[model samples]
Each structure stands twice: as C-alpha cells, then as structure tokens.
Target chain A: MVEAHSKIISFASYIPENYVPIDDFAAPADMPSKLDLNRITGLEGHRRSKENEGTLELALQAATKCIERSKVDVADIDLVINCAVGSLCSELRSKLSPSLANLIAEKLGIKGAECFDVSNACSGMVTSLMIADSMIKTGQINYALIVAGEHITALVDEARTNNLWFKSKALASLTLGDGSGAYLIGKSELPNQLVFSEPFTLARFNKLCVGEASKNRPGPMMRTKAAQLQQGVMGNLGEFFIRSMKYMDLDWEAIDHVYSHPTSPRAVKKGAGIAENTVGKIKRLHNESQDIANTASTSHCMLLEKSVQLNQLKSGESVILVSFGSGVAMLAMHFYLPEGIEQWS
Target chain B: MVVVRAWKSSSEKTTNLLKTICNLTQNLLSENGISFDDIGVIIHAGVYRRNFRTEPAFATHIQGDLKLKCGPVTQESNHCFSFDVSDGSCSPYVALNVASHMLRIKPEKYCLITIGDERPNKQSNWPYQPITCVMLVALEGAGYQLTGTNFDSSAFDSSTYVEMIFDSAKSANVIGESSSAAQINSDNSKFSGDTNWLSGRHIHAFLSQFTEGTTNTHEIIDQSGKTVTATWV
Candidate 1:
C-alpha cells in the first residue's frame, strides 16, 4: 500500500498587473458598480493581463515564482503538470497542453521530466495534487510542479449572447477573474502540511454547466439551469463530506477552515449546508470579481493561494478544500498546515 | 445513446481554423440534441504550428463562439497529431481523463469531440500529401463498443511490412515530383533516370522474403471511394 508523506513544498500566484474594475468592462448598466463589487464579492479589484499576454506566460510567471519561493530548482523537478483551463487556441486541434510542457522544459532546462496537463475545472489544483501525491508515493516521480492559469474574460459572452443564465447568473460573470497559481509537491522528512485525505466523485450530476460551443456541429449554447441547480443542491456534497471525513476518520466539527471553488455566495452557502457549517468555519472570497468565475480547473488552486496569503490558516490547523465543476464533479480533501511556516505578519 | 451524425471538414485555410470549426461544430450540435452549454468541458489537444508561435487565439476562438465559461485548452504542439493517429483511443481517453478531473463530471456524462486539419505547404520540394481534416465526436452514452487491440510489430519479422509502406509513400512522392518536372521540360521519358535504384533493389529484396506464403493479404476501402486491395506478398 502506498502512503502519502507528501506536502506542498511551496506555492506562488500571479495576477496580471492591469486592474479591471467591474464598471470599466461592459456589463449590465443596472448591475452594481465598482463600489458594490467590493461590498459583494469581497474583492476590491481583480487583475487582468495586458493585451498580447497569454495563458502560458501567466503560467510561466507563477511557476517561476513558485520555484523561487520553494527554494527548488526547475531542473530538480521530476514532473510538470499544467492544471490550467484556458489555451491560446480555439480549435480542438490547436489546444496547447503538451506544448506548454515543452516550453516549460526548455525554459527550466529540465531534460527528462515527464510533463502533461490535467483538467477538473474549479477543483483542478486539488485533483492535480492528488495525482502528484500518488505519483510521488508510487515512485513514478519525485518532484512535481502543478500550474493553473485562466483568462475567463476572453471566453465570457458579454453580449449576453445566447445564455439565459447570463441574465439570472449575471453575478457569475462579475465574480470571475483572470489569474494563475502554481504549487510544488515532493517527498519530505517534515510532517505534511497538505494532507490529502480522500477523493470522492459524484459524476451522476454531470449536466450542471457547459461552455465553448462545439466547432464541428453546433454554434453556441449554455448549460441548462436544471442541471446546474441539481448539481448545486440535490447533488453529492453531503456524500463527499461524509466520505472524506470517514477516510480521514474525523468528524465535521474537526475541520477548522473550508476553501471552496468560489462559484458564488449561494453555491458556497448550499455546499456549507451539507456539513451544516457546524463550526461556522467556512470562509469565502471572490464573490465580487466575476472575471474569474467558473475559471474551471484553476479556481480551487487560486482560492487556496488567496486563503494562505490572507493568513486564514495556521500551523496544525486542518482545512477542507471542496471543488465542483460543470461535470458536477465534487472532491473534498483534508490538509494540515505545515510546521514552522509562520503566519503572514 | 447519441448517434454520431455526419463528420465533415471545411476546405478553408488553416489560419483561425478553430473559429470556423467551432462555428461548424456549433451548427452540428444545435442540429443534434446537444448544445454548447450542455458540454461539461472542452479538451483541445494536439495543437502545433509550423513554427513556434504561442497564442491563445485558437482557444479564444472557441470561447468566443461557444462562450465557454470555464475549461482548459491544451497547449499547441506537434504531438497534437498523436491524438488522431492514435485512433479514437489514446488522446481522447486522455482528454476524457483530464476533463473529468477538471470539470468534476462523471466520465459517462460528457461527450468528447476532436477536430483537426493538416493544410498542404507548397514551399517544400516534396510532393504534397492530401491533408486529413477529420472531426470525431464520442459521447458517454450506453450501448457502444470498440473492438480493437494494438500490439508492437517490432517483435515480429513482419515489421518490414510496415516500413515498406512508409518507404513507398516517400518514394512515390519523389517519383511524382520528378515526373512533373520532366513533363514540364517536355522530356517525360527522362523521369525514369531519377528513380532511386537502391531503394528499388531493396524493395525487390524485401518482397522476396514474403514470397514463401508467409504474408497475409488484406482488403479495405480507401478514402478515394475505391475498394483497394493489398497483399503482404
């Protein structure tokens, strides 16, 4: 049996320098303005990449910063995985997962590290962490690098073109943002900070959300509201929480913090209800910055970074990161803070 | 189970082809029961340019057309073609795996669509091979089966059979290009002088090994609407 003695060696995140206030971008005129964005989403502002910058660049920046903070060399990396949700191309044939790997290899001068991409929407980072942990435990890799970057603004239909949810879920567009986050995981003698407890999937509620019209057959369309609500409400959050707790052999009251995918205040509230928010320990962010909304695979990673940066977690404290995406996939994992890492002053 | 409709490709240039493909794909999905929003995730694989140019334009095109709220598109690289050549097995499988991971969807609830086009480049001296522009759609519906197995041919002496086909394709290009040049010179008969005598001799030698009733013959329909037949002999 493989045991996980894995911990996040270091983490880094990058948001573009350009700031896009909610009012500057084209949105519903009647919708709340910048003042309301700060009040609602708890976001004073969100970062937007300057023109001509792409997802790979954002990833590179975050990865480099992560390597620097982790005090590890890129050449030491045994594997590199991109958990990002956006690409520079529109055609299925032109997607850039492997190419990004090649670029990272060339830049880091790592000769033989296995590189690839993974997706699971908002939960992508945690899912990637699990895979990296497994690989490390199985001896498939020693040092793993996971990066996620999303440019949701490029994909949003500001025209409210075809989606009815755009009217009802206009808040989604406002809450989304563009950014990137990276993590380095490896075997260590130190006690693990991010202890991956278990992974439970509820795929039966798959039709919750959709985007990027198919290029072969259809023109464009959005996901049905029925699937979305089912995934949000009647879906498997309760089971996920129960299974995770069972795997960790802990009760709901034991968790000290919760970092969700930041879908919306409503989704977060409903998910919290699954565990009955028993300790009132659930904390949320990005309720205002819609630019990053449904950033798919990158949301969880980004949220985790923010939570850490905000000093919301402390040494020995256990936190739960729950993620859900359009496939209605939900994963709950338990992580303990590493020893010796001081809280942000 | 969702039945696959027609698989078509446009004859347009490869520039910004993703947009055109997305438009065409959307039309196809609308015609069917599926819609863009119904898609849980979009996995773009095997993206490569002739030269190194990294821009999210291809993914951006799809996002613009389909209004994808969230989904990661794969980076561009020559390996993109590996997804297709691997048949409907490997790349799509990887895409499904990643999509399930990212979209948090059940593997059974989503559909995987792959589209690609290889445009001819005229600058090279080699004869132009017709580019294959194919679009494949596989859904997570029930009552479907794929029956096939892949094994390494290197373990058998029959490996030479596959090598010969590749050699033939290369030699055919040379012969066709030289013949065209000869015809332009008004001396078509001179084209035979440029034939690769060494390769011809090797081909003949390679054929002799199969003459002892050791090889099998197979027949399949070619893309040209012809019942082409081939024998290892």
Candidate 2:
C-alpha cells in the first residue's frame, strides 16, 4: 500500500469565467429543447473565452498559478513543457514562432530550464507529464512543469458560424469548452505517488477524432463522431483497464477511485458502464465534461484539481487517470496521492 | 552499448512527402537486415511540413504507408503506435530522447526515430527542403550509448554550450568514444550563435563524413561559423 513511483507536488487549473449555454449554439428550431439537450448530452453549458483570450494566455495563467502554489521559485523549475502548443483551440494553434513553453519559462524567470512542447490531442498534458516524469526518474531533470491550454472556442465558432464547416451532425465541437491545467512533478525521496503511466495510440482509430486548421476559417476546427468515437474509446479503455490491473498487480476492488476524461454526460454514463464491468462496482470521478464540456488535453488534470479542491482526494489514495482523445490516443496513469498535500493551487 | 544504425534520405519538391518517409523506413530496415517485425515502435517528427492539411499525426500515415499491421499473424502482439515530437530545429534530438528512454526501459525493443523537413516553396531562411533522417536505436549491448543528452534554452557561449553536453558525458565517464559530432542548426540563432547560417546541403555533407568514417575528433563549422564536433570510432 506504500508503493509509488513519482509524487505529484502541485496542481493548478484555470477555466474562463465566460459561460455559453446550449441555447447559444445557433441550432435549428427542430433541435431539442434545453432540457432535452441536457438530458441527452448530460451537459448544460461550458466555459468560453472572452475576446483577446488565447491558448498562450490561458496556459500562462494556469502555469503561474501552479508555480505560485508550489511555493517553489521559478528558477528551481528545471523543465517546462507546453502540452497544448499545436492542438490549442486558437487560430494560432498551428503557428509556432514563439513556443508556448519557452515563452512561459521566460516570463516565470526560469532561466535554466529545458523546454519543449508535446501535442497529442487530448492526452497531451499527461503525455508531457510522462516525459517530465521520465526525465526526473532518469536523472535528467528534477522538477518539470507541465501545462496545457485549450481556448477551443475558435473551432467551435468555426463549426457554428462558417458555412464550409456547417455540418449539423458534427456536434463534438459544440461540447468543447476553454480551460488550461498545469502540474509540477519532481523527483524526491518522498516516495512515488505517481505509480504507473503509459500513452498508447491506436492509429486505426486516429481518424475518429481530430482537430485541424479549418481551410475556410483562420482558426482550427475539430470534428469527432461523438458516438462512434466514444465506442472505440470505451472498447480501448476496457481493454487497457483490465490489462493494467493485472500488470500493476492492482485489485479492481481495492482501487480507491477511477477518474476518466468526460466528453459529455451521456458519454460518461456509457463509459461508466464499462468501468463497472472491470471493477464490479466502481466510483467514477468525471466532472470536467459535465462542467466545461471537453477541455481536450486538460481534462485529466482539471478533474484531478477539482477533486483535490473538494477534499475528495486523500493522501496515500490510489486513483487511475484514464484519458482518451484525438488520434484515438489513450493515456492511463496509476497514482497514489501523497500524504500531506493540502489543496490544488 | 548496442549498435546504432542510421539512414538519411532527402528529396526536392519533386518527391512525394509520404513516399520519402515510407521508403526511408523500408530501406533502413533492409540495410539493417531487419523487418518491421523486429521493430518495437515508429516515432515520426515532421517539424517542417506542408502536407499537414489532413490531420496532425503524420505518424499514423507513415504506419499506414509502411503497411505495418498488428494481429495474430504479425509476430508481435501489440501493433506499435507512432506519435510526432515537434520542437522546431530540435525535432530529431527530442525524438531521440524519447527513443532512448523507450529503449532503456524495453531493452528488447528497437525504436525507430524519423524526422522530415519539407520547407514551403519560397525564398526563406531555411534553404533545406525535403529532408528525412531515420535513426534506429536499441539496447542491443552493442550500439552507441547516448551517454549524455542535453537541451539548453537559455543564452550561453560555445564553451557553455559544449559543457552543457560534454560535462555530463564526463560525469558519466565517457571521455570520447571516437569522434563527436555536433549538428549546428544554423537556423537556431538562440543556440547556434551563428551570424551566417549554412545551407542544408553543406550540413548534409558534414554529417555524411561520419558514415564514411572519421580519422580524428573533428570540429566542423557550418557556413554560419557555428561549430559542431563529430566523432566516429
């Protein structure tokens, strides 16, 4: 029960205060009412960005809060990874003149940091965190700052307003909200709280979910077969969950909690059914999608942060972070929250 | 230490983007007397690409192009998954870092690191275009051990630059395997510290010397007057 790998030192998240309800989606009159939409989608509204907001800004806000909360000087941070560089929800998503991580490190006064950006759709933050974790575990760097920002409104805007992208059936974009999440992982004698981590991609299903720079619009737009994508993801999740439990010698019954990335309320419920099969009876933590649609890569961290803030997570507790996203990439992490961690900054 | 096999491929605008990556993978495997069956995973990095209009991960397309399959008949149970690592000029190094870690963990696995550059057809800073290099690194107990891997973003002189890399190597106790090579990406003004950068062709020639075998530890300077030392035992 005391076994662990890397401990999560600090966690922080930022969600834009702007709210855009389903009513503002510009759906046709034939579409379902607000109540039905809520009932069907399990989502009533999501956070949106105000004018002049972008991925870099949101990423900075999240990183700043994380660094500030960690009580560690910016100079002490050895590495900074921007997990939302190319996949961020902004018109400049594709543009990489000034890297997001480099800029953030500069502003934070982290002059001695090794920085890079890792983009793998929604599993990005975790992917970057894994890189930092490996670096720390391998003795390359001690402290790594991992951040992801999704100002995905531009794509949602393109899908809603642009005639070229006006595919009424493509509703995945409608569920996306804007937010950023950051985590600080350091190597210490404090025991390994982050036990197991892996990012696996099934290229066969990569086409199911993706975000790209819209041809007609300047910003990036995403198209996902919400139902079909959810099916593929659940199937993969079921396989990974069963296999991981065996590999890590974890008992489905002993597992304290299961936190999965939620795209929609309906999707969460459907995924929960899969969860039940593996663990018999499972406790699921998925409020990101419910509160802020699909925050893409930041979903896992945001969910973790929320849980920490609510005091739902306790020290020495075992939890599984299940994230599935674009490219159909699946990232599963096994963690033991260290004792004495106060709250998410 | 395992034997590291490297293969490089470059093309002009005339070459198809996908063909470049696919052919390079096949050729590297054939030259090494191995097949996709022997490989663990493929990691593709196309930091400079014009054919990204479809989707982000061209690694998937590369897997498809190479016709790699994972099933009951494929020898390996899990089909290897590929992902891109984008870090501008540092793309190959980043991919190498990831591959190194993978190989370190799964010693029986051979990770293929692929990087391509297809610059847009325009008069630009980077005269290099349509370049792809594949490095096959594994933990076969016979390949070059990447004794030290370094990434420094802050400002530094050439000594500091060399120290960031070599000091760690010294600490690791690897004095000099044979000859050390530096890829002075003249385009990286922050790190390269070059006033006039070298063309891709020139850098290509400099790296080709490694394959031909080196006589001594040489410090090869690109047209940008930036130095990168290369070593071959």
Candidate 3:
C-alpha cells in the first residue's frame, strides 16, 4: 500500500489590488490593464510586477508571503519547486526553476536547499505535491515548498488577436488571468489524516488546450479549436471523475468539496454533471476574481486558499482538486485540510 | 544493425551546429529505414549554446526541421562550471516529460539528442565545456532495451591533450591576419580564447578521479546509431 507522508502546513495566494469588470476586460475594443483583466475574471487580483519584473520576482513575492505567514525558518526549507506556465528565466539556456529557487533561497537565507521548476500546465501544483510527497515518504527530503506564479494576461493579447478560437470564444479571453499561489508540505510524524491519494492522466487529449504563439514572439496562443476544447472538456472530465472515483472507492456524495479548474461558468456547470455534484458544494473563484483566471496550475491552489480564507471549507472535509491544461492533461487529487492549518485560512 | 556518429568540436552558428548534428542523426535514422514520425520521441541533452534568452533553446530550433507534431524538449544544465556557463536542464525536461506522459512511455524509450557548439565569446561562460547530452528512443515499444554497458576512462589524458592543442593553435593564430580575423582574435583574447583550455583541464581532473589507478578504456557500437568510447590516464 502507498504510504502517506507529508501534510500542507501553510498556504497563501497573491493578486494585484486593482479590479476590472469582466465585460470591460473582455471587450475586444478595449485594452484592459493587467489589474483590470484580473479583477474582471474574479481573481482576488494577480500580483503585478514592475514593468521590469520577471517570473522570479513574482514568484519570490508570493513565496515570501507564504513563508512569512507560516513562520517557518528559511533554513528549514529542504526543496522548492516553481511551477509556472510562462518562461521564468532570463536565460532560457539554464534551468529557470533552479535559478528562481536559488534566488528565493538567497533572499530567505536558506542554505543547502534543492530548488527546481515543474511544468505540467494546470496540473503542475498537484504534480509537485506528488513529487514532494514521494520524496518525503522516501526520506529524500523533509520539507518541500511548491510555488506557482503565472502572468497569462501578458500572453492574452497575442492569443486573442492571433488565435481564431479566442476571437470566437471571447469569454475564454476573460478567463485567463495572472496570480501566484504557494503551499508548504512537510513530513508529519502524526498519522497522515489527509494524503494525496492517486494521480492519473489522459494524455491523448494533451494538445486539446494550450497557450502558444509565433516562434519568434512568444505569447499565449490557443492551439486547439473551440470544438476540440469542448470535446476535450466533455471527454476527459468524465474519465477523470470516474477513474478518481474508482481509485478512491468514493461515490459522488462522498466528495465534500470540488475545487475545479475555473475555465468558464458553462464549463463549470458542465463539470458539475461529470462529478455528480447536485448540491452546491462547488466553491468557485474564477468568476469572482477575473484578474487571475486560469493561472494555469496555480488556479486550484489559489482557489483552495481563497475557500479557506472565506471559511467555506473546514478540517476533516474531503476536497477534490481537478486541473486541466492545454495538452488536454487532466489531474485529480483528493486532499483534506489538517487541524491547525485551517486557522491560517 | 545500427551505426554511430559523433560531432566532437566545431566553429559554426548555434543553429547551424544543431542542424548539422540533427542532420547526421536523421541520416542515421533514414539509413536504418526509420521515419521521423515513427520514431515517437526525441530527447536533446547537452550544456552548450545556453545564450538565447527567449526561444526554447532546444525545441525551437528543431521543431521546424523535424516537422514534429508535438513532443517534449529538455537539457542538462547542472554540469556547468558556473551559472554563466551552465544551460538550464529543467526547461528541456518539461518538454520531454510532457511528451513522455503523452506517449505513455518511460524516460528510456525516447531518443535523446545532445548537441553543443561553444564559441570563443562564450568562453567566459565555459564554452567547449565537456557536457553529455543523450537521446533515448524506443523503436519496438515503450521500454528501453539495454544490450551492453561500459564506463572506463584511464588511458589518455583528454584534458592535457586538449589544452596543448588549443594553446598551440591560439599562439599560432595570433600573428597578423585580416580585419575580421583581428576582431575575432581580439574577442578571443578578452576571455582567454583557447575554448578547450579550461574544459580540457576539467575533463582530465574528472577522468583521473573517476578511473582512480585503473587503466580505463572502453568502446561500444550500438544498434541505435550510438557509439561511445572513453579512456583516462
């Protein structure tokens, strides 16, 4: 039997303060600021970096906040994994994750920490948790910090102007936002009450949704047509829910909360049918914080943190977090909020 | 039956260098009657030409030529002597890992291709650094088949010999030449040209430690168009 090893000690999210209405931001005629776009999408507002700030800067800010709130010593951090959809390094030739890891370590005064980046589109946070859990269980590392930061708004224009789908499905343009979310996972001697159960992927649908543009000018471009996007969502959402249910031996009613990839209102409603959630246990932040829609993998983490802050979820409650990315990659993991950690929310 | 091809050192544009190496790789694949699409996945590994800041250093260059529908790309950057010298390995791994997940295969099934061309200007970042890039491809299915293995390096001093050759060439080439040549010479002089100097010493030191007192020498030719030979003393 797979053993449960690590528990999330603390979590935090950062969004810029500015807010923009959804209609104002999504209008093709208007050029909305990042703050406005994030606000309209119902994201708490993505943390905006100075014009000169890059991926590492945004990541550092969010990570520092999580660390500070946790009051955990910097030296105690054994590993850091930065999961972002956009390029994080000034030098694409080197590992952007480790570079950011090094920067965070230096700033936090953490010595002898292993730092790297993980990219799996929307499923990045869940994947990072799996990796950290394995490492902790195997005794490779004691504490692992998973941080995801994205500025997809920067890529939205190119995606909308160049891609046919974004032009047609204008609603999606509003769904893409910017923000960062972080979680601290550490080994707990206490019995693992809530552990990462299992992870499965539907790779055949990997390319169904993605963000890419021209080769020379990199930006967010929707590769899959809108039809494929619909099909992918319909096809994989069922597969993910069914597989997760079978693996966990959970019925639809057993799931206490549904933390879904906040793609759109329609998509979320459709997803409700797949997960069999007749009750309104589904807590969504995508529409509430348009500023940070589809923060890629960080979306789930940010949403979870928000749910906690809103006092919507409680300890001992089972939460199912599902993430879907462009490659049509789908990931589902079951988790529970530990006892004391709920107070921070 | 498979053949092995190696591009040791070169003076060429980064794209050209990559094209040449990939061309050689394609030739090997074609001669074996293998189609590019049938190959499934390609892994590019190495620690050279970590200069470009925007384009994915590996996939961006090869995607057009290979006509690859969609696959992963990754590199090994930890081996760099310094930050300036090391290319990031994680970016490439992201691409490769995604491809692997899509194809539903192990890391060993994919074919890995590593190519690097360190120029004189890049020496400050340790160009010509001895880095290993590997490509793994599975023709039969997902699993990789390992037929033979060998790791010995004690017979020849690659570092000392490389330094001698580079030092002699630099001293000889320093004499009068054209304006462009002079400019190249000046640039080379700035970073202590002789790209192979530092690399040679490092390789020798590594070999000495790796082989200990044993006489290390080995060679192998594989069906996957890969040939590896090493000796250290």
Candidate 4:
C-alpha cells in the first residue's frame, strides 16, 4: 500500500453576473470627500450578488462545477468542508446551526459524508485544506471537498446606508464582492501535488478588523482599520514568505505563479515587493482584483479559476497560494496543477 | 495515538466568552503541567458568537488572551496556530478529527480545543445560557487515547436546528427565533442532548460517563440526524 497525499483533483469558482460600478456608491456626508475609493482599493467595480441568493446557493454552483470537472462520482466523496466566513442563508439570515457544510451536502445529494464548517475569515479555504490534507495522510478518508461561498457584500450595503462614523469605520467593506470557490481533494501517491506550511495566527492584530450585524439594519457590517491591517501584514511578509518556502522546501524561483490574499491590488503589489526583497522575485504574481475587487475567502481560488480560463497556467506547473485573514490567520500552500488543466478552460 | 490529557469548563457567566475560555484553558494547562508555549494549535468550535461577530476566529482571541506564542511563524521563533470549527453540535468531534491528524504528523505537540456558544448581545434574544469547555489533546499522553471517529451525515434533519433571525425592533440577529422541531433522547448510537445549548452540554454528558469509567465510546448527533462517534481507551 502506498502512503496517501491529498491532491487537488478539481477546482472551480463562481462570480455573480451583476457588476456594480464604484460610481454607484454615494459617499456619506461624513466620509472625507477626498478619500479616493478607486485609487485606494484599486477596484473599478465589483460583482453584486443576486437577490435571494446566499452562501449555500453560491457554494453549490461552484461545487457543482468542481465535481463535474473531477469526473468522480458524488458517492465517492467522503467529506465536505465549507469554509465560508459569511454563512448567510434563508433570506440572508446569518445561519448558526445545521452548518453550511451539512446543508451543502444535503443540497448536493451527497450522503453519509462527514461535514463541517470552518471560519478563519478569508484564509478559510486554505485552512480547511490543511485539515483535509492531514486527514488524508492519516488514512482517515478518501476524498474531501473544500468549499467556500462568501456572500460578503452585505457589509458594503451596511456601510453605504449607515451614518458618518459608521461609514468611516466600515470603509474597507467597500472593497468586498460576492463569490464562491471549491476544490475536490483526493488521495495521491505523487509528490508536489499538495503541501501546506503550518498555519499561524498573529492574534495581536485581531482587533484591527471585525465583522458583525448592523447596528441600525438587518444585515451584516464590517469595520476595519485598513491602514494598520495592511501595515501589519506587509511588515511580516518577509518572515511569512520565507518560512513558507522553507517548509515546502521550494526554491524561490521554483514557483511559477503566486496567488495572494487579494485584499487590494496595491497591498498585493507592496507585499510582493517585500517578499521578493527577503527572498527572490516571483515569476508571476496574480492580482485579479480590479474587476471583482476582494472576494474575501474565495479570492485565491477565483483567481486560480480565472488564470485557468485565460490559459495563463500550464499543466504540471508549480503554483503557490499565500493568504492572510482577519484573525491574522496566515498560511501558504504549494502545489502542481494536475494534468489536463486545459480541460478546465 | 492522540489522547485527551485534561479538560475544564465554565458557565457561570461571570465574564464574556473569550475571558471564560481563556480562564478554563489557563487552569487546564496549569493543572496538567502544561504551559501556553506547549500548545501547537488551538481550535474554537461552536455555533453562536457575540454580536453575530465574524472575521477573527474566536480562537485567536483566546490565544491572545492566554498570551500563548501568538507570534509570526518563522524559522527562529515558536508559534501557535489557531482557527475556528463551526459545526453546530458536532464541532468537538469534527475538531477532534482534525487535531488527531495534525498531532499525528507533529509528534509530541499538543492541540487545545475550546467549545461554546453565546447570544450576540443584550438586545438580542438568547435561547440558552452560555457555557465554555476546553480540552487538551496530544499524542504523547496517558489519558484516554482516542481510537477512532466516524461521521454519518445523510439528510437535512430539521428535527433540531437553529439559525439567526433578525428582530426588527432590536435591529439585530438574535437566537430568539431559532427553533428545534423536537427533543432528542439518547439511544445506542446518539447521545441525548438539549436543543437550546450547543456542544457544551453534550460534552458534559460524555465527561460524566468518562468520570464514572463506564463508557469507552461517545457520540454526538446534530439536529440533522448527522452523527459523529469517537471511541477511546
């Protein structure tokens, strides 16, 4: 018998068709008129979620694509992990029980699969992957589907309709967009198919951002110390990147493509510079935020799916994913795109 | 094999959620001759949170409050990884499965998991009293070694369920509107549990049996008829 390694068999992402232009947002009287949302967020517009659509629906859409691409029977899937931070369902109500994972499995007609939900802000997908990878290596399960559907723009709506102080505090919410992503992970004997560095949380910066229900409305809201969060993440980039490389035992130049947290184009560009200064230059660092802005937890996979559709990624090439979430949860994953990558296109 | 070294819990409501978890964690670590630095991972599992709060994992707050090695992960420094597992009543078992695999790869390192839930705020309606439970699991330990865990999730069993509902008057997501279709009594495979409280009460029952040295296996079934069963020494 061969030792098992978790490999990404298939992956897909979903972005809503509705695009909302930045100009559509009316600046609150209290917001500094000079605060340039475009230049700061590096976003021209973002995807708007359809009415009555929520996390479960978006996740199912992406999960369907991922499963279809895998060519594997749904009955063979033994695990389901939902990593959506915004777990809204049923009239956009924040769901607390019957976890999004269980609900997703039910909707997909997947039976007898172990299911659960993970919340680590935007690093959720990668964090859930770590668990699935560990379980596979331990001979616990055969296949696991890691999924996330972030119905995140409710925070944007909350910030838009609220008062002055609320708008200022929730400014980062403006960059949020709705999206979903899914990865079908299964056992493999090949090397470099999937590898993860130990995830760390710099909880000292935990208070830099927060998301909760609206004080004066019926939906979600977010407040962020945007500058401070960026500074903290960028300041630690050198060490995080170096450690990730070391753990995966990859030469800096071995990486072909890099996908980061996708908070903003400026932040990704700056953080990439800091990482390169500490290590070496990346071959291609992807920042697909201009049209869709930050898609929260689904950002990296969404970018990966886009890269595939554009023919930018070649089969058997090494790609690395780096992510940092609001909990200050951080991790990096290195993997090789499986054969038949062009099929996803 | 990974084992449960020690456990502690609190439900007095003397303080907020994070503080309660940290207090229990501190006591569990001290009593078991462990330290904050000894922990390699922390997983918080529950359903409800204060203010419907999302973003930072509640475990991060606990790790920060306990002053664990909450530093950047680097070659020269020690660090602790923390995240949250939200599986309603099945969280502890799910977290246990994840931690078991993690500890198996990193021999001798320990993982601390905290489980609990609370109403978001005062204006919001709360269904049950808030309670927090902490468990220390590790590979090189002398306690009940976890042998295995299995999960059976087939359908959407709404017999027992809960979801956030907006109270127009309060303008908040509260637990008041959340409902459980029916109460579940213990049988052979599933453990009896309260519909209002989350995993803390189920854990309490499991601990009671463990204390009496009567049961070697425990099971938790969520409102969805999904069940996770774990056997120990």
Candidate No. with top TM-score: 4
Off by over 4 Å in 1: A1-4, A26-45, A89-94, A97-99, A157-171, A190-201, A213-227, A230-235, A277-295, A343-345, B1-233
Give per-residue CA lDDT, model 3, range A44-82, as digits (tens): 333334554455555666787788767788778887776
lDDT of 3 by residue, B14-110 (tens): 4354565566556655565555544433433333333222112243244335544332111210000000111122222222323333233222233
Write model 1 residue lDDT over A1-345, tens digit each, in one string: 445467777777775667776565534454534225434544434567656556666777778877777777766787777766544422112232122443454565555565555544555567677767766754556899988667555543332343433444434444556688887888866544555544332333333444432222212223334335445544445545555566566656756766677665555655567566432334433232244444555665566566666676566777676665544444566666654345422
What is candidate 1's local distance difference test score? Answer: 0.45
Span of ten consecutive residues with least summed lDDT in model 4 chain B = B176-185
DockQ of each: 0.04, 0.15, 0.05, 0.71
For B7-37, candidate 1 gives per-residue lDDT tens digits of 3444454455455557666666666566454
Of 2 and 4, the candidate ahead on lDDT is 4
Residue A122 miss distance in model 3 (angstroms): 2.0
Model 4, B1-233: lDDT tens digits are 47788888876863478878887887887887886777888888887788888778888888888878866556787777888887777788888877876675444368998988776788865556656789998875577677777776643575345666678876666764544434345576544455445787777667656743434677776665666677766
User: What value does the lDDT take at residue A177 in candidate 1?
Assistant: 62
Candidates' TM-scores?
0.56, 0.82, 0.60, 0.95
Which wins on TM-score, candidate 1 or candidate 3?
3
List the pairs of residues colliding in candidate 4: B51-B120
